[model samples]
Target chain A: MNDARRHHDMGGLEAGAIDRGEHDKAPWEKRVDALMVLLGQRKILCVDELRRGIEELGADAYERYGYYERWMASMTNILLEKKIIEVGELGARMAEIESGRREALR
Target chain B: MSRHEHTGGPAHAHGHDGYDADPTHRHPPRPDLEDTPLAYHQVMQMAVVSLLVEKGVVSADDMRAQIERMDALTPARGARLVARAWVDGGFRERLLADSKAAAAELGIDLGPIPILVMENTPETHNLVVCTLCSCYPRFLLGLPPDWYKSRSYRSRAVREPRRVLAEFGTDLDPDSRIRVHDSTADMRYMILPMRPAGTEGMSEEALARLVTRDSLIGVAVPRAG
Candidate 1:
């Protein structure tokens, strides 16, 4: 199915016009917009990983299609705003989770 | 249904398929680790670094110090970003459309590497494997989980993603489409899996509980039900 149809079928997403002022908007609002696309099957993604994957596919030349570092920074900011993962919490959590799993297996 | 689907060619060999059968104890040679294979500028940088070190232009102490600092660094910021993306749709969309913009929004930046987003759809599942090396989204997901960085996972994910997923308990039919994503470029990718059930009205923290680092890298499916 086409992107538009797939989007609509999944759930109507209000991917409003690409507003530059999105920079000033709250992270949660931006998240809502992104989620709409995912639910709509717009293929939620990470631009850096996508480029890396493409590059791995032997498209080193094609990898330079866009400015990746800049996009990663921007996308990261959006995710941070939602507090989905705390800035400094990953390390502790990893330790706790791993330790628990190890204990469980033992 | 057999989860292993034959896409085109038969799957490539894994790193440890016959590791025990080596008559000689020679390790495999490392692949080229140059930042850019054909870039003249990098060639010049390597030449300069070599020349400088030969002439004591830049002290080995300085180099060692820099390496030490880098080694002590943790990738928590990137992990935070991945967890956040798992919960927020707008950010996820922005991440897919433009990763740099998304990263900037979070105040973390990757100077030169371009970021890319690949989603895992029901029809087209995405699995990430570092066939050549252990390249991963360290910043977003912290250190790579043991399973993800394992030789078995790297080899199995690419050659037999359906079987691998089933091993991880994500059963998919053989006919169900599969796309293996390799994190080998200057760009990085994170999986946007289908949200699990029992998460209605759950807070981001709760949602994060379900976002395993492996799932973010597309190795394992998010737990649902």
Candidate 2:
């Protein structure tokens, strides 16, 4: 189905209880949000393009991810689509960062 | 009835046996990443930002300035606007007519996105939601609350708006019509909730204190002092 009819089309659906809890903004989430806005201001990407990238996330990821997590994933996809970064390079850098984080935790 | 007819769209034709049922549908996992499932995506975001800086797509200062700008905004600006609108009838007319210009009159630059002010009246209550994604009036109200972005709120707001409003502790009269505005496009929305009674002589500053962030989102009403 097209975007207009996808699962994200939640305008009128039966849903469970609303969780009104507020969480402190995580540092990484803030950075990602700022980065996306910065990129948009520079005309490197537009809001519609970003929205499209977000909507393109497959059904499972869309359901499982948090708001900023979805933003991060969409930004990554947009950068890759625009050829600002290669897929292989992104994977390698992500692996390096992940390993570094694990080391610090240990 | 056909599956499409039952679900109201072709998207749900696959029913429960679709995407989630596929054994290989998982995103490639990174064991070294933070233990939470979301951690991998966060790391990938950092990687993307690093690559953008390295490639000279945007400068470090640009990122810093953007972050600072976002940090500087708060819902206090929106609260002040609502308070001013309550006290001055002419200003309230302007706010209802042209929200962006009215916001500018009070020194709030709403950026490029058009903001429409929805007035909550006795006969009709207003609620805002972005069912597609969490589109909000960020320029006026700062970042939206977490629950505003939750799937439950997004989905249920349009289907059962009265129930949702009641959950927010905003019990409307049974006869009051509920108008749910979905921010699907470029235009963002903010609610100018009806000013509470018993605050007739209250100063605008004092009235501003009564406007909560949830009230601006139309989930609740400004409290009486």
Candidate 3:
């Protein structure tokens, strides 16, 4: 982690190959993108807050996820921080969905 | 009783969710979860949006409208502007003077983000990068390509612009200075690449076809064919 510059700062760092292939956006990714724009347009959250949330993601998660994944994580964290949704509720809902998927698989 | 296995073998005989019996059983890598159709982060995003809707933070209609608005924008708008500027010197002057107004004249809505048109001359080549983040003129050019947001492009574009441009197959004169614009502020930048040689009589519409998205981003120039 280059602490001298912020985590989001990527200027002048050595990085790997640039994948130029264009892939279609997944459905969930599209919805998440729209949700972010809607939230911004409605004044529910600002771009700066979103950027800060993304920047605050620990080094591990930051390097692990893709661009949209980071955005989704940042938006989720911001919502949780603002008390829009409780952590327990979010976790329970996720678990419920996971079990539902397991049931479908079985 | 490992967290991972349930067959009741010696791995599960101790009944501690199988993890304790095998200290080597590390948590599944996180990237695997993202490969699934509905990634965990996507689910979390859905949950957050659902809760926000239920709490009256934003309506479903608002989201739909925003999605529609984004869908309506594409790089063709930028192509049209570049093509027009190429055929008309006066329009090019106006475009460089006030990009927003020029875009408006060409029926392109640039949204709230201010756009600055950086012309690429023989003496100076222009490249755009948001060193702080992936900030491009989305209103006109649409969402940036994956490489534009990559850590490599963002970092290398500003540090060694000529080398970066070379990677994109855009080799410039060694003596021509390269100006890398780090779009760290509210304003977004677009490169107005010089028109390629030949086809002097080509229509503006025909010329627009040569203006690839990469050219608008300054990674490559508009090719003539």
On TM-score, the leading prediction is 2
What C-alpha lDDT values do all the predictions have? 0.47, 0.80, 0.77
The complex in candidate 3 yields a DockQ of: 0.38
Can you list each candidate's DockQ?
0.02, 0.35, 0.38
Task: For candidate 2, give the lDDT of residue A49.
Answer: 87
The alpha-carbon deviation from the true structure for residue B44 of candidate 1, after best TM-score superposition, in angstroms, is: 27
TM-score of each: 0.44, 0.85, 0.85
Model 1 spans with C-alpha error above 4 angstroms: A1-106, B1-79, B86-88, B143-150, B173-175
Worst 10 residues of 2 chain B by lDDT: B1-10
Candidate 2 residue runs with Cα over 4 Å from true position: A1-4, B1-38
Per TM-score, what order, best first? 2, 3, 1
The number of the candidate with the highest lDDT is 2
Model 2 per-residue lDDT tens digits across residues B1-225: 111111121222121311232334342111222332336667787788888889898878887788778877888888989999999999999999998899889898988889999999999899999998889998888888778888889999998998898899989999989999999998899999999999899999999999998999999998897
Give one digit per residue, the lDDT tens place, for model 3 in B103-215: 88987888898899999999989999988878899998877876788777887888888878888888999999988889998999988999999959999999999998899
Docking quality (DockQ) of candidate 2: 0.35
Ranking by DockQ: 3, 2, 1
Residue by residue across A28-65, what tens digits does model 1's lDDT show? 22222232223223233454434334333333322232
Name the better of 1 and 3 by lDDT. Answer: 3
Candidate 3: C-alpha RMSD to true structure equals: 10.0
